[model samples]
Target: MALPSAPPRRRLRVAVVGAGVNGIAAAKAFRGAGHQVVCYEARAQLGGVWAPASHYPGLRLQAPRELYVFPDTGPLPPPEYDEEYPTAAKVYAYLKSYADKYGVTPCIQYNTRLVRAEPLYDRSDGGAATAASTAAAPGVAATVTVSALPTHAADGGKGLDGAAKGTAAAPAAGAAPAADAGVAAAVSSTGPAAAPVGWRLTLRTVPPELQQAEAGQCGGGGGGGGGGAAAAPAGPTLDKGGEGQDAGPREWAEEVDVLIIASGSFDDPKPPAYKGVQDFLAAGGEVLHTAHLRTALRRALAAAQTQKGQQQPRAGASGGAGDNGPCAIAAGASAPGPAVVTARFPAEPERGTEEGTEGGMEAGTDAGTEGGMEGAERDACRRFAQLLAGGRRVVVVGNGKSGDDVAAMLAASGAAASVTHLCRRNKWAVPRAFAGLVSLKWTLGTRAGVSLMRPLHPRPWPLGPLWEAARWPLLRLMEAGMRLQQGLAAAGAVPPHPLDVGLDASLHVEPPGYFAAVHGGRLQRRLGAVGALEAGAVVLGDGSRLEADLLILATGFRRSMPFLPPDLYGKIVRPDGTLDMYHAIYPHEIGGRSLFVLGWNPGLYGCLIADIAARWVLEMAEGRIRVSREQMRAYNERLYAWADAHFSPVAAADIRSGITVAYTWAHVDDMLHDMGASFARLTPWERLRLYCAPVAADLYTKVKATIPSERP
Candidate 1:
């Protein structure tokens, strides 16, 4: 293994943007290793996305407390840790307390926004023949630009956002590479003399989006991202650092050494093409990004803003008012209770006549060995429940059945209602896990009850269990449903499908669509297109009048390098509109290792998959590895051959847009293997050193060496 370089001797100044969980985690890690860390949040608190409770009524964590909670600290109410999922409010309070305990709150600068991050280059050393740059110190000149194009070259780096039309064009042949720099003086100025305070980041305050005034609404996207989705129609800008101003309000910018972008993430956003998005996608639609919506809602409900914040329980909800205190279980597996978890499926109105539920069951049994797998589904559900039973709460995120199943398992496992079942799409069946049990609770109507609702999927099609990966979950749900109602046909009521696709007959088909995450959520892989989907419906492209009271796009977003420019996943298209992000990390041989992507790689289980990426990031901090400036270009030369031969997801046009869904007993293992491979193959050594004092590398070593593994 490559070794970490010696620690920096001088006191380091580090700025971690987004005071959310990740930000808090990073700061704790840094401080533990002796670095001075300053945390910043655009809003007034440390919880990035978690601060405000949008769908808070039912919110909870999906992974058990063991995995979700940070290292070295405990959540408030100290999770039952082996009982039931906690509520969203509990999670909120727990996170707040988490930050407070670490003293992270004092260092956090809330309401301080960072719009853009320009690395300062050094110029004082111009007298030297070669450009002398110092990684240890900061005071520099010109903004060192870090650009990440697509995985492939020649594909226009400019994404397909509709508004940015005119400037996107092919480069003239033989044009001098103006985008590059050659003068030694340009590189020399950044030498050691100047102590850089922090990055010069831009922070533009945007006005709130249109909402019912009471519900609350605003906009934002993935953390560390620097691209704009179809810019909402022209509007007033919120002015920041109001200096000499223009007619409209201007955004704000801050200068700092390291920028830990924690903008959170974009749920599968719709491509520029999906139909009906025009309503919410068009002029008057509220650009309510996931977090903004939550934040705005909180602001609207503030006791000062309104009356005691009249929060309403979801469509169907009921159960124990909520967890009064933490459970008394230990790290040992299994929730401590007589109530074991099981999937509670929606009864098929007519059983097998519908294709989805029944069809999926037929497909599942047909695809696998039934005898050995008979109890596998139950086992998986049990483990899932055990995971929640350990947490203060369970947050069932994602767009599909996995989410539903997550909810189902929690409730049946004698789960106390601290569960938030978030279905990414409005159109779809509830997972067996949450369908009957939780749905019944939701229907019962009670505070601290199951909140069954879809967030909205923006993929072109509304229903998407068609994805191959979904078959297993859908089938499992099918079997479970059948078991619940013996003699019932294989299919559930498929009249409208999860998204009410072909079932227009049922007025319940409200258009926005379903979360593919349901059912192993494997169907997304089937519908996910490599290119903008062949949208049968159009907006400005065609005079199609569209409407989606809620238009959710299942179109995935950039997971890694959000601060980098927009490139779908890591694929950067050139001006000509062709994609190429080498190895899906760097654009090509031309891009520097310092200017590429990571984390954007989608994984199956949870975020930070096994903390492998954490290991890589820490290495990059210590300068143990060096990524080539010629990123994917160098790696692509080899991977292209590999793709031509194997046609893995990179080459396979199908399955490109979906998150991995093979969630059998070995699903988590699959995630571990995949993440290990990516991390093992391309070390983070190539990334530009953003901060000297950051000792992520040391922390990883300590954790890996000392922390006992909590087997999932």
Candidate 2:
């Protein structure tokens, strides 16, 4: 079962965008294959979505610890992380350790972004090469634009982009000199005469002061101050500069022989547009996507501190009797009314007394604030917690895993007066530990579990008909079991679709205490789209209104490749917003072998899938796995057709989603077969184990070990 040896290839100057799971894998793979590699990460740190800036308060891994590991890196250290599902911080640390172990950490250039990547070509033949010219002669085949991000840690620590505390920031390595800050091109060592076939990349350098200000505005919850009243901006708002800002970002350029995009799909946050959102913000109500939970929490604390500082009388406020105050509502509450305000603030004491004063000092004195900033911050945190558990009315949008986790977290913590969950429909959710005994990794994550489901194409002979006949009953039985286990029927949250249909659409793991919260009435579930927002209430699609102080949108992210040229982007992405990639890797229209995309496909285990994709890219680069344009087109057509038939309409509508969820093993097997790995040709015993054994990352160790190393 040995694979045919690939012909030795020339060393390539490879540039990888992103330093996340996929990016690290790509860098390690390319470097191992004797290619020059440098990875660009826009954030000050790696870990991708697990980075500190992206963590929500109660975030934990969706997959079990064993299934989330990188095969080459082995399992997460058990002694350090005892939880079956590790917290976000633990996962981030594990990723960092993995990157360091593989030598990928030092190769990463933090705080550097890939702005644009355009194909380059030679026009010496009196014919210019347009993006449409697939077979154009290659001589300097592409041009990429990159920018140096600000020198600031997103989580409010010391800047990791090469700046010391209270000191001026230094320019990133390879940045242009101060005088030539504007678009300077550094030709390859081969010179203009040679013009080797590669990408010419432009780099932008942001000045330290402007970068600091931008970081202050958008990062670390705006230093936990008055600016926290609003949700954190999705990204750095440097483009929309204020008075006294720098003229613009400085620019430079370089060249590379290859470009790999591993930015992944979670980059763009998709907060839906609601009517009167402006009014909501103006009224001091916060609207945040789940990605900005840290920011939202900080803002809540800051607003609470401000209100405590003011110590205004409740009677002067706009709302009716039992109202804490306008400022209290702004902090996180609605007035007592028929709108179902279930919590209230503790009664305030007379203002002049020390007991009523903040920090136990007399009312008019500055002595209460004398304990310094740290002490004040602690007070704010305590007050914010009280407000969260005792007074706030929160409305959560979407019912995906994130939505469920958030609602459950708030309810379990008693963080809201009324926790209302809004969604179009309920999704089927299974518990992490099936039947309260077997971990899902051993059930749904195993090949045996996948075998129970119908395949993308019809199987041969009697087995096909038998499977088809049994599938419906099996789905119904599974649905009934899950319904009883989750108490979905009792909570009136049972999904309308069967188990198979539900999996095809989206499968969620029930968050801890979610069903309990629902039954106990701490969390209320409402099925409808939000129609509008007015003052302190949310209007539902049926014209019913619910009092709300905070809104959290777990609506997920939008897939985009803004860094690619428009023509190339259009070719790779369909008009309907679905990706048009071949096996979710190569673009059909692109003729050259210089570009590759990783981490686009969603599956059961991200780290394992991404590592395999990286190895597949390495194989293609080394000429070990080759596909003709016709072959790719044919395969993609079949793939899309299968998706249309097997997936739910909602899931099939966007192929970039978790389309391979339950069938991830089949997808992995296909890729391994393409790579001609010996593991793909398993013995009878190994094959049996493959189907019956619990799935783990270590299963692919042999495949990884067999990949071609650097040629002498």
Candidate 3:
């Protein structure tokens, strides 16, 4: 590999992937660091997740625009919050504006998606050592050794010394076993022990030849200044499913100075990681993979590949862990910010009074059906002044963070929102109902009891099903949770600030996948009340049954950060085939620089972590901090160790069977530690991974020698 131009003696070349919010925000930081940064995105649009026309109907911003807006931007003025929440268009507009302000638009290549992101390590600096957690960091010649956990009991919750229900006990050995442990332990001891282990992630991998997302239309590899072959043509998108889709082979570009992965949890396509990913990993890629990976991801890619059909692809949104947070932990209530009012018309005090259905539900009553449409009975006009002077549930129906807050408040206040209760958890809305319980993610999964819903089926699946999308994100959250615990266990360091949290789910939608019209992957299925009903807690397509006071759909959006797949570090994929990316950033094994997620500052409030994320990326790009391999690992270990000390209490609880659960508080809790000890702190999480990588080189051999197999 020759110099793309002799690596300009005093300059560093950074390959900024994606121009979405996360990617763009990162670009700002990179620019600040004074690096020659070139950003690429697949779509012709600059806003990764903010592309408007592609957003679904009635879509509103997940978090308060104020909290969610990029770092240096201001949300809509006061009057904006007085009425309704910001819609996807509103947010997207804001995103575009943000780009304009930060000078991000110019540096971004709209149609160029980062088909691949890699770290172009300076070759002169010796290549990575095989399986060595102890190797000296890149650029730095000194060897740094990270010791095991300290003896201090790490846990920041109600001191374990008190023995209260919310206390953080020592890390228990009963944590999850390897991913291939055969059957998954019940979601909790209570979830249907007999409920087939974890759901199989059966990806109906549409054979390669016909995939979307892969169509290189964005002028990909047009040439150096142009984009060489990266953008040859476009492909079929999921907007046209199961058809003549022509996508590219899983693309690769692992060797780069900086890598950014922009695909989010449920949307963008992820053709199975073939040779490229494996080779990159084998050679040490600084990839940062996310749990948002979902079936639609592939579908989106497939959609992109549907070139013969010449169909367009999806924008950024997906379906999973929206505003309500993934599990009970994230669902716990935070202080109420301005409640974005949806319907603003006055409640007509009648059962059915048709208001305005022009563009959106007029702020008025729509003939009260059950319980006077919850909040519509009170204060609809004051919420959003821009809306009409009436009230409607539609404003609150779609799961906006504001709506969830309002609904949760109503539920906690001992009132009914007219939503059906998930029979097993004995809670309303499957997402947030049982949040208060320590680990009762869902009562069924926590208690050793049988579930009302029977098994969907069972089989060997490398990837979980797309139907179980809500629960998939938890898999990675759990893995990170486990490694945090394990790292602390070995370090023996006492956890300093443990968090006690709860989660809730308000994301409700009809299932039994079928669509009346499919243009751009938007399934006009008989959704909402008309399409389906929960047969036994699980939402099913019935069309005739619509029983509930409210329905809040928590639709997650698309995302992609830096260095995914091959260009990755940490224990993202343990030998057990489990993910261990601690804090959603660095890997548990090798602590390389990383980019985690960001959204509403609700569950976790550490602007510092966000700041740090922005800062770290910038520092790495500008050479302010040359992250050596060991330094990277050590940093990860230190953070995980601290994360365990601070947030284990919330995750330790058990979740329910067949229900998606997440420790929102715990996830955010890590943010707290990150806020304080970011970058500068050489905590255990970082040290261990950095040193462990080398010392444990041939890590498997070391383990095998210590514990010989009986078969031998």
Candidate 4:
């Protein structure tokens, strides 16, 4: 891969918001390009969503260790780290180590929040100075104002052992130390046409007491004298938040050449809005989104431990010493491994709200239900399993991976006496092991297999039955493989799965032990939508009701950043709420240079995707990459066309619902094309082996090696 030589440009002062995998990758890449890098993480820790606080007890990576890392960061997990799906704790440790190895930890400002980011212009050429003015012309620069609060108010203003604290002359809120001036000057000196000045971020640090005070003041309780010691200044105070005679939040400004928004999606949990959800919560029934399962479970376990101590406390279980699974010693929680549990990986299901008529599979047009969940269904299942034993009658909603997981867990644990699963539609299921030996993903999780499965021409019309008929041979082979692994026909779960009506019944990795348990009558699979929640029962739309003590949502998270201003958010996001970007990384218009969004890309191998995007971002900032406006427009059109062709009816109903990047190969190829490279970068033999062989994590190293090294 050869990028055009970037013109001579001064180094940049890059600011990355969030210390997640993407943010860390961006910081490393930018710093490697001789730019000054600073990362802002709202949490006290470096790992964004993977921080121990964000994950449940048994959470682990879906991808194996080989695929979990970037080639440049570090080697694959050693024997010391839990191999084969490392636990969330191990993952966080790995990330922290990676940041430390690259010296990104020192650059990260923990407990710093980005309150607002307004784009700034250089105006040395002084055409238009307004923030809204177009940057299509040259000499534009960006400055961000930010607020940095104490790591913890109770800690007496200490920040990460004073590493994150700056001198009193710096901004009132935590700002970059005095050494940042040279970097800031270099950032403003970027090429006007290529790397424009990015954003002026306004950050505010909110200590716990201050947060409560602000909440009270904003809520009209009216105790306005909430004064807290302000953080050191990075630059001049652009604006102050407190009213007269009472100090509020202090703000500081920062100038950077590039602003990368690596804010992850998991922060916002989207609970489904069922009609009787409020009433159920009010009646003392719990509705814990899968995100908060760890906290909830910990509290429950603590209560249980306390109760046991009051009685005659038996010896507590050892931390599963010598266990192969990744366990967080601090959390006192065990990770799910192959011990006592059948190994099963979660399949990616479609996304949307299920909206189907009374009868199932009507007219071949309505394949099943509407509504698809987000990625990370696997962890949600493990969290749900932790709660299974507490409930007498468990009702699992959304018959996707989560529903299957709950059903299988209930049967395997022998926890719930009656486990009823409300499945409105029949979805395709593939056994984890296809022939009881080979992994199912190995068979179809490749580009070759996906290419074969995809239709040659777009089937826009509702010709699902015809498409099924055409692909009957392959479908039959799939059915046979599934049946061989999990005797579906012998167990009376005939036909194996629903009709492949316009991809309505796409095959997914079946949770282990689901069909067998259902066949044994331990778990009942009911096909109908929930009408409402009566006193202690879930009423079905078909006039039947099942008594359920615990109702698990299994619904997905809402992947939106509400913190972004409405006008800026509206421009970046489409009318349908889906991101409108080229290659899911860069916007088509020039104005997007000031801001970049990462980790929002929908695809497998997210870490790898972020690495590639980080490479592109470095290239863009250094003026090494260029794509014509017309070409960008065409590329976006192609993406929209493919999405329209592939998305399920339910997914199609909402613009934001469908998967942006469908599979691994095509998405990677599209990125390569944007980077002025081709699959040709791989050798002829390696190209042939791409679909079957493990992804070459070192591919980025090869690509970067091929490009001429810059001034750095």
Candidate 5:
């Protein structure tokens, strides 16, 4: 595939506020367009969520491996992975390789954090500048504040030696590094004065003690890097000298022409704020998000080893080197893998035991009527098993891919005495391969399959007429096939909403052996919200309670750019809290001139989607794509209306943050059209294969080659 040639325009100083998949894509795109790019990553590594610190046991790609690769990079080698979905470690390695292959690694500033971004609108007319101001004078348009977090051993900060390779070293304490020399020289040579519409960014260096302390709360130890540090409070601190003393991390500032927020949606975990949470913590119960499971489990195992030493004072009592003890290693010595277990489906429930009208719980009294002594003994045994990594009662909240994976991991671990999964809604679980025969990538993942569903926008030509006639029948057929493959009815996991409606919300792949765990009674699947937390128990919305030694909330994340000023932030987020961006990349109000947001949209094939979005950003920056603010707003309004109408009410509330499932193909198609590139440009045979064969990242390389190399 031919790369887009450098445009015949003055170079841009592009600042990307992340080093994740989307961030790498943005940097590669801008740099390829002959722009100077710098990507800032909070962690020492560049994989974002796939970073070692963010991974938990049993973490694997929910999508097929082919669908997860960057468009420009192609697929993971089959001989290397030999799996439909690769594990987190494998993905991280792939990302690092991709970065190196594309020269994006050197452009990344490791251990740098975005604090705040204040727009510096051109006010040459002497008028006060505000976020709403639309002055187009070029140069510096915004001031972004970023903190350089101190690196620690636990943070894997040595991945790139604490800075971009071949870049200048960090400046002395309290000193601001000069602007990129290459960029400064280019600016001076191009014109009499630099453009006045660029951004001025402020930088700070965090105190090591304060940064390490924050890292500890967020699973700061080895392999469990500071994934939760973004949630930690950020600001200047007061000195011991006096109340007026301003003492904090070292601060400085810089400027840039374009600011792309590739920070992603999963920065902040959104655990439920149930009543009595503090009491539960005080009572010695552990509450963790799926992101921190590895750290929590390691702590439990270490504590168990300590207890064993105290109880049995003899050598090798804890476990002989070769002994397969209670904490015996599973698939890998470093991380737990899925355990194979026999499945025994429960007999049909009595007539009255079906899903209840209230909370989807079985219609019966709470299961707390067991003899008091027996219940107490059972609780004590479970608690002891928790320490030994054997018999803890685990409660996992949420039904997304993370929740399913975690629940399955615990159930199959042969560790938890019982695994209870609590969710507010049951979702259609799509299998990677339907009936162990047809890969979803060849069907629903292709453009032809997307044409079978209702579209947010009008389909073009032949597809529109075909869809109008066969949409319902095709969708129904696909749903039936999914139902049969998933064995939803047999597993007692039929979702309330139909598959079409569910697609608009979220699509979670059924984890291996997940349904078997449910059928065998090892995992209890219930539908209800967590009403509150009590001493060693979780109270359900139906007033029922379950004893739990560990609570894992896979309840998802809250997406926000807290660094943006309130007025600017409000322009991007809607009144009801959904994002209001045009094409989920350009802020509608700003029209994609000085700012772009990537990876904010919830969708499938994220790597491919982000790459397309990045290319689109490049097109906009080079003046190949243009739209007025009114046009952008109209487009966004239509998108919002489509979502409200098609998405499930519950899903609609947080529509922009969850995966859009099957519509992802449609989303990509829309962007392709906007960029004047399409599958229509392919040869007849290639186009046929594109619609019928399993699509991979490399398939789009040809399509992207048709994108004009320079603005006309």
Candidate 6:
């Protein structure tokens, strides 16, 4: 008898929001699996964060580029671009190319915004089902609504309001308003009889043709569509006219089997609410969040470049006595001595801002008369060259990657008058490489390294003492190596080395210049908090003052899904401020499989993890990987319990950070086991040579091939 053929697999009509790395990858995954994928991006272009609008000029990858690309995708950078760590522009280009290679760009609708995705009840109209019988039955489907708006109105980076800004626009004749497009896909019994009820989507799109049509309707009043001749002449426009509501964009809706929230963090800019911040900005003291660096730094650098070009001597000025009498200023030399620092107190308490340290040396100290510039100092001076770029007095707040990166960039440029970093605590900074020789990937990114160094829970077994004893020799050796190679202690008085604190206080560092800069005094690392800002000055916690013209807040972002309804949001995001994801991807019990979130975790390899998540989601949709509600809840409880017991005090304050660090290995390892994939391909002898190697992205290729081409 002939072998039985597998049943036809179900294909979903998937809606993916955002054209970012995660979004693009998601679209590709769904489309490649024979599903219809529609990607909506609010911006006019792809490459969400990597796009020119979101990043600064000097931005580059913090980690190695080796694992940045998808494993199934071929060697990237195209050989034409040979840099290992490419600039922001190059990275953006790479993303664009990836979309093209995967054929995902075509399905993406640029300048489209997601308005809202509301669940549509099948049994009842609008309210929740209170009956136990009704609750046990298949739940209602959801509908997503989006409206089309002008690019200018949508790109303001405001919250959902910006997205829904033009939703009230009158529908034009013969045009398909976003509201009319709320068509759901037909369910087929052969493929997905058990598929979860779908979603209703509201979306908005701005087409050039529609803009011209609207302009013609208005008769030269522009695309505003207000009181002029452009007003719709007929009955039943997209919006049901109402008082107190402005004319919004045209909207439409669609029903999708899968709704992928690929709208990663970074859309909303969180501004610092320090006292005097508004006063300083109003007084012409420029203040910007790092999110605006791409625009802000680009303009500043272009102006400086132009001025430098104009000041350069013409080709004729390089010769003899006839060419020039005396050189006006030494080439490649800055003004003699350190920049001046002055203190100023506001005539009146400007919002009662606190005082801070004046950044220059003490009154009696002399320049170039301190300790010899060696080790940390040597590193600091090297970093100072980048910090002073553009001759701007900069004050960087927060000690995250963005803060450290910008500080180093300014110090190394040697164009800034002063660069001082205000930090809350002295967190451990792990160098990109251990001992300036071994890549951190080979040390911290490997299974052995993490397993050997992970903190043990005393509650479990007397394992805490055992872990401490086992790691003592390795910890001492590693500490000694770091001190000998980098001399981090001499750089500045950070807290006791993280190793001494059971690795609780450690912070990962990329590019490895921060420690050197801090210790060498090239970058002033102050042990205080920023109280407030005044004209030309910032007040520190210790009542000291620092003069800064440009204040850059490098505070990180918050994870939010404004599009999600309160009921759904409550289920996915917990009261503890942590996402209640089963594997940091799916909800424990979302009634049905209507929603899945990607790119929400803090992992060493974000791109890789997202790819893995895409695979897992697909498998779940195919009914191959089944996760019970009880099992997922138990897993999450254990994960959080461990975090509460072992993480540092600082980490405990934020549930996300604590769980992220503690479960990094378990997260990836468990996912691999679920997919039946190995982390590496090494000979028996080769595996013994190195302590351990980091998991390569390509290791999933074999497992991916095992996924049946037909269906589960």
**If both were scored by lDDT, which would come out higher, candidate 2 or candidate 4?**
2
Give the 10-residue window scoring lowest on summed lDDT in candidate 3: 338-347
Candidates' C-alpha lDDT: 0.29, 0.54, 0.27, 0.48, 0.54, 0.48
A best-first ranking of the candidates according to their lDDT comes to 5, 2, 6, 4, 1, 3
Q: Which ten residues in a row have the lowest lDDT in candidate 2?
A: 353-362
Query: For model 6, how does the per-residue alpha-carbon lDDT over 211-330 read when each residue is reduced to its tens digit?
Result: 223221110100011101111212112222332113333555555556787766444434456777656655545555554333333333333445554543321112224312111112
Task: List TM-score per model, in order.
Answer: 0.44, 0.73, 0.38, 0.69, 0.73, 0.68
Please report the candidate that would top lDDT against the real structure: 5
**Alpha-carbon shift of residue 258 in model 4 (angstroms):** 1.7
Candidate 3: tens digits of C-alpha lDDT, residues 1-712: 1001111223333445445555666667666556545555444445433343222122343222233333233223322333233444455566567666766666654333332222211111222211111222342222221111101112111111222112223323432211111111211122112111111000111222322333221111100111112122222112222222243222211122334443322232121221222222232211111111111222233344354466433212222224211111111122111110011011111211111111111111211112222344223212211111112111122232322322232232222323221111111112111222322222222211111111122213543343245343553344345335323233231123221222222222111010111111221112232222222221333424433322323222222222233323332444432234433443324222223232221122122223335554443322223233344445445533433443333231111100112333233323333333222334565445323321111221122122211110
* Model 5 alpha-carbon miss at residue 249, Å: 5.2
Residues 1-712 of candidate 5 have per-residue lDDT tens digits of 1112333466666778777778888989898877877776665556666655443333456556666777766534533345655555567677778877778887776545555455544332332223321222233233322222111111211112233111234423642212222222222222212112345444333333344432323322111111322222221211223222124343334445578888766555556567876666566565665434433433343444456555422111133243322222222122111100000111111110100011110011111111111343233223323443355678989887667766765665556778899988778766667877877776666667666766767768897887788878877777888777767787667777766665643465666677777877878988889888888899998999988866877766555665665556676887667666767787655332567788676565667787898998888766566454456567666765776787676655545533345366667877777778857677887777777655566768889988765433
RMSD of each: 19.2, 12.7, 23.8, 12.5, 12.8, 14.8
lDDT of 4 by residue, 1-712 (tens): 1223444566566778777778888988887777767776654455654554333333344334555566675334444246544555666677778877887777776445665555544333322222332332122223222222112111112222232223232333533221222222332233332223355555555432243333210100000011111222221121233232135444444545567878754444344555665455455444333333333333333434356545321111111234211111111122221000110111011111111111111000101111111134333333334443344677877654445544565555555657777776666555545677765445544455554354423555567556656666775676677666676656544442323332332233455467767777878877778777756677788879888756655444445544344445665677765565656666544343456777666444556677888888886666555554456667667656655665555433222332332344566665655556545577876666566644555555665565544432
> Candidate 1, overall lDDT?
0.29
Model 6: lowest-lDDT 10 consecutive positions: 354-363
